[model samples]
Target: MKATTMKTLTVSLTPHQAAMMQGAVESGGYASNSEIVRDALRLWEQREEIRQMELARLKRAYDEGMASGEGREVSADTLLKELKAEARSSG
Candidate 1:
């Protein structure tokens, strides 16, 4: 992927967060705090992408149910009995 534009900005962190990033760099696990931050941003981006996908799935399911025409009325007990019978047959 083409490199995105970079910006330099100062950020404040709690002592523990600052120490964790510093320790990573000192241990040679990361080149610098900026590298650690960038890696973290990538993970945040992926998590957001997955979150959006789940929301889309839910929306689609809702639309499908809405478009399924009139619903039939069934008692909870009757529905549960049928569901149990279906599960047993499938199993």
Candidate 2:
């Protein structure tokens, strides 16, 4: 990839996380602390995108369920029944 424009950032980290990033750079897996930070930011951004998509899907499902006029009431028995069904399917 071509080197892109730069952004300056400064932040503090826990000792353990700082050590881990330093070790990763020293281990030749990353060229510099900036590289490590950029990679981490990219991964976090991807995760945020995934979470947003999941939330949108959930909202759509909730809206559709409401439109279907299914009972919105929940009781202990209903919760237990769903849990039991999940356990049975997994086991």
Candidate 3:
């Protein structure tokens, strides 16, 4: 595997946060503070990507519903019954 290019960053940590990083290094859990920061950023990036995908899905659903034209009001119980009937038939 090829290594990605790295850039240096200056970060400020609270006393507790600084201690946590130092403890991890002392315990051999991480090679350095940079590794821990990189891991955190990777996780944050993944979460942001998932959030964006979900937002897109919600937007599509909203657009589809709006384009579907005027809607009729149905009772909650009636809707539930219809949904259950559909599920049973499909299964």
Angstrom error of the Cα, residue 88, model 2: value is: 13
lDDT of 2 by residue, 39-74 (tens): 999999999999999999999999998899858678
Tens-place lDDT per residue, model 1, 1-91, is: 8999989989999999999999999999999999999999999999999999999999999999999999999999999999999999999
Itemize residue pairs with steric clashes in candidate 2: none
Please report how far candidate 2 places residue 59 from its true position, in Å.
Answer: 0.4
TM-score per candidate: 0.82, 0.72, 0.79
Any idea what lDDT model 2 has?
Answer: 0.93
lDDT of each: 0.97, 0.93, 0.98
Worst 10 residues of 1 by lDDT: 1-10
Cα lDDT for residue 35, model 3? Answer: 92
Candidate rank order under lDDT: 3, 1, 2
Compute the lDDT of residue 40 as modeled in candidate 2. 92
Candidate 3 Cα misplacement greater than 4 A, ranges:
1-7
| Model 3 Cα lDDT, one tens digit per residue, 1-91 | 9999999979999999999999999999999999999999999999999999999999999999999999999999999999999999999
